[model samples]
Target: MPRVSQAHLDARRQQIVDAARARFASHGFAHTSMADIIAESGLSNGAIYRYFTSKEQIVIAVCEQGTEALPKALTPEAVAGFLEYVRARARENRHAQLVAQIYAEAAVSPPLAAVVQRQLAAMRAAVAELVPESRRADAAAIAEAFVALCASYSQQLAIRGDLDPAPFTAALMAIIRE
Candidate 1:
């Protein structure tokens, strides 16, 4: 057997993360298992463990990835890009269910809760940067409200299967502008 380089190892780890995302999104955190990740990733159990110690760690990684990827989906020019992405995703019925599921699981899982908090903080920081110093405090409050609104809207769409993001976005923009 040959030794794999750090790059190969990193790639393998990313593959595991990607597989975990799909499994967690589909089956949820509690239902998803190490075996499930291994099966989905097509990597042996031993190889999988080499990258991550446990399923919980994988969940954290996925959440972290989501947090990092989200900002890239939006531009600084458009302060509401994140909201628009959420609205479009809601309409497509993708990612919203997964987000809701993770949010539910985070309520019970301490590690997940911490990860979610950190992600939220990062998002708030990004939003805060877009505002002038004089209005930073107000901007932070508005960002919090925007997050709460999106979470509520996502939950509604998930449960009721009725998504009307236009009105919500309009109202949110009005509030931000004011």
Candidate 2:
């Protein structure tokens, strides 16, 4: 057996994470198994475990990726940009469904719930920094409102197949500006 170099190991870990994202986005965190990830990534069991201890860890990583990957600024222009991003992602379908599934799972799963809450708090803190000084006190509230609006938009897209986001974003910004 040959030894894998540090760089090779990091690259392999990234491969596993990428595979997990696709698997979780398609099959969902609950239904996706380690073997499914193994098949998706073409990585051995040991290689997979070398990067993550369990499915929950992989899921947390995916959720972190999703949260951290979102645009940070909350300005009107940024909001519009994010709306477009969300709309485009909605068109993709799979990843949006997976995110919704993760939200549902987080509601019942205590461990996952913690991960979700933690990531949301981090997102709020980041947004808080970007918020104007006058709005600092409302940063957490604004963050909550922003998350709720996006979730609602995602649900609407899933249920109604309607992609129009302008009205929703406008209304949300109005509320935030109040």
Candidate 3:
């Protein structure tokens, strides 16, 4: 057999992750199985196993792919737009529900918790970097609150469905301007 290119391998891996993400979002994590993922990916069992050793590994991969990087220049308008974008994506993909599920699972799974913590830490750092120099001393705390509020907004959308981002955005702007 001819050797597959690196890009091909990466695409295959991403395909598996995408399939797993869809399944996990539709069905809770505890309810999803490796067989479900394999079927969802339209790949054989061996093909799925080639990329991920187990379902847990796939779960971590999906979590690692969570939300895009925060914008470099954070502004109130930017934050509002970001929240609206996230809400729209959540409605389309049910990813916000999946994130809630991941948080629940992380509460009981140490390895998953570690991955989540690392991701949160990175997001907080990114948000902190966008803070004004005058707030540098409190950037860490500001980032924590900002990240937490954003997360809460996502969760609210997941549970409540189609809420006005106006209120959430207003709260976020308050944090950003404070």
TM-score, structure 1 vs. true: 0.81
Error of 3 at 1 (Å): 2.3
Q: Which ten residues in a row have the lowest lDDT in candidate 2?
A: 65-74
Per-residue lDDT of model 2, residues 1-178, tens digit only: 9987999987887898889888887777778999999999998999899889998888777776676345566677787788778778767745567678778888887888888888877766676676667777897887777777777887677556657778877976775687
lDDT of each: 0.74, 0.77, 0.87
Q: Cα RMSD (Å) between model 3 and the true structure?
A: 1.3
Q: Give lDDT tens digits, candidate 3, residues 11-76.
A: 999999999999999988988999999999999999999989999899999998885546556676
Can you give the lDDT of residue 176 in candidate 2?
67
Q: TM-scores of all models?
A: 0.81, 0.82, 0.94
Best by the lDDT measure: 3
Better-scoring candidate (lDDT), 2 or 3: 3
Error of 1 at 29 (Å): 1.8
Ten residues in sequence with the least summed lDDT for candidate 3: 67-76
Q: After superposition, which runs of candidate 2 have C-alpha atoms over 4 Å from their true positions?
A: 1-3, 68-73, 133-137, 158-162
Which regions of candidate 3 fall more than 4 Å away from where they truly are? none
| Best-first order by lDDT | 3, 2, 1
